[model samples]
Target: MEIDYASHFSALAHPQRLSVLRMLLRRYPDAVPAGEVAQALNVKSNTLSAYLAALRAAGFVTQERDGTSLRYAASPAGLSALFDGFLRECCQGRPDLCRGIGGDLQTKKGTDMPFRVLFLCTGNSARSIFAECLLRAIGGDRFEVHSAGTRPASQLNPLAVRMLAEKGHETDGLRAKHMSEYQNDAKAGFDFVFTVCDRAANEECPAWPGQPISGHWSTPDPVAVHGTEAERMLAFQTAYGMLQNRISAFVSLPLETLDNLALQHAVDDIARKD
Candidate 1:
């Protein structure tokens, strides 16, 4: 089959269009509602429709009708074709370079070293806890993830723990701790420090030892939501989904290639989407 790499590249040229593709990739094999995608990207419905249409035309994403609204997911075949075509063109007649292409691509640059990440919030019970757990579940081998709060909770939130358990995430070693613990410890440092709530982002934080790149991913406090048992559970689930989406985007980044300034911009861009 003939492939038009130019069209595919053109389709992905727009930043918003690329973001839509990444969002779909995160939920690959599972279609997400168009409205949800738009909400996550903070794009106008009309604008997002246009972006999706471009992706569909390029064969990067597939859309299916689920009752009234459309659902979208990444097309594995299209992605494979795009990548394979690039490699074939770039590595032609270079057997040695092509031999370890797959292995080298996955572990390229600084991926060998464990990246330490810290999630911070006003209270470590909910948002930060969920971020810590989700990142560990997704990128534990590559990242040493931790969470802390300015004012630590006495214990982990039961709802948070239950959500993690339901999602098949480990909760055995998880507990609330004060940010001061990491701050005062000379050896404690992080590659990235993320503030998951507005309160924490506004508050003055300790000067991290390594001067790690920092960004704010503001999420509503699920614990603060007052509602019925079902409603409360729903709140927790919503928060979990938000963090999962953000972390999925985080894990997908080509961290080894992006410098600190570029990495900081990328982190800030991810937060702006939500």
Candidate 2:
């Protein structure tokens, strides 16, 4: 069947619309909920609905009936069709023009190189940091863990730090950082990247290289909780517990035994599992 390349290009004309597509592609093979996409893009439900509809109409995105809610993901064929068409008709078989389209997606991990992993949250002060520490403690020699925020707070949250200390984790290396510190993974990206909060889940992630598998393990924002000191700490405790459970299961996975698609589904299922 002939694909309408013009319609697909036109649909991505709007910047936000284009962003939605890119973000979805980053989470390819794993669809995101419509509301989560809106939250990530900071768009009103109606506005995002229009953007998604255009993408959907152009066959650039796909919509699935996930229970009662709608989920969106980049269509597997949409961009590929565009590229094949561009090379055949526009670039006239210039393979160099297609170099930027795909990348080496293999995991080149070895005994000498630890399997790199990254965790993300918006503020970086709490959840992502918590995850970095947890994975570091649990993953041992097989993993090298990192965490960052989309919009990092100036310092690590005192409460988050205190709680970790109470649990006996060293606090010296826990600094708030932006994701860009690990940017341009086009040559070598993390083996896995998980967004632990809803905000970060929606936020546009870095262009991961080498087929980094991604998952959304949405934990409640401890900082967003506005309550008494004790109650607030409880939020941190709960978030920490949830993340601990998920990360334990994650590090326990037989990663070496699973292929990329299986690993993708495994990590994605980690979200729903806990």
Candidate 3:
């Protein structure tokens, strides 16, 4: 029987497992300790162990025993197999088009020129909250970023706060603010307005003087999900990973070099990521 690479890849089909892959990919060759991985995903040690085991069995990951800790990294052959497998079978011999799409995915602007970004979603709880935190963490002082919601929730999602805090980013004073707060103001306003959930993107937005660039990220509602504590935490972490990938690319673009049209395209790309 031919080996179904799809089945192997399917092992990483869970939200948390894929998150672990991207997180490990970002830290490749560095071997992040298991404890850190657990913390990053807001998962318990046992839960993380199970997820890691699945990934290892799928050949997507490897572990190195570091004294009292087991650090994890992506397996070279595993990743290549994954890339080749996906590209060969699904891409329909147009790998170049796929590559082009990836290239156009999201490019970061140079660190020299910073842009103020506002992340919007229907509820200020989960997805939008994560996007705001991730962008600031990845961009540092390079970009001014904030988050808001159309129908603002009562608070920031606790899981989101905890997850970002584990990554060394402070979430103090990160309350859920309403989009209307910035909607009518004559302030300088956001250079980019991003809606991270489908509902927010579809709703009418408040007018701004400059009508800052806008885009829709369409992330799933993590707060509405029901599962075991570990499973729920994993959902938030997965969303974080997705937001981080886009933000990483966004922070690397040469925003100073791009004219309005290019910048608009760039922002659009950032908001369109899966």
C-alpha TM-score for every candidate: 0.60, 0.74, 0.57
What lDDT score belongs to each candidate, Candidate 1 first? 0.79, 0.82, 0.72
Q: Tens-digit lDDT track for model 2 on 1-274? A: 7767677788878999998997786565567898888877788999999999998888789999989999998885777677678777878877667554223224443345678899988899999999999998888888888999899999999999999999988789789998888886454678888888766766655467655877778788999899799999999999999999998998888887676767776787787765
Residue 22 lDDT in model 1?
75
For residues 69-103, write the lDDT of model 3, one tens digit per residue: 78897675686676666676767757564452222
Query: Which stretches in model 2 have alpha-carbon errors above 4 Å?
Result: 1-15, 24-47, 57-112, 184-187
Q: Residue 178 deviation, candidate 3, in Å?
A: 0.8
lDDT of 3: 0.72
- The best-first sequence of candidates by TM-score reads 2, 1, 3
In candidate 3, what residue range of length 10 has the lowest lDDT sum? Answer: 100-109
Clashes per model (N, Cα, C within 3 A) = 0, 0, 7
lDDT of 1 by residue, 60-159 (tens): 9999999988999778578767767766785573665544222222233654667889999978998899999899989868888889998888998898
Off by over 4 Å in 3: 1-113
Q: List the residue pairs that clash in candidate 2.
A: none
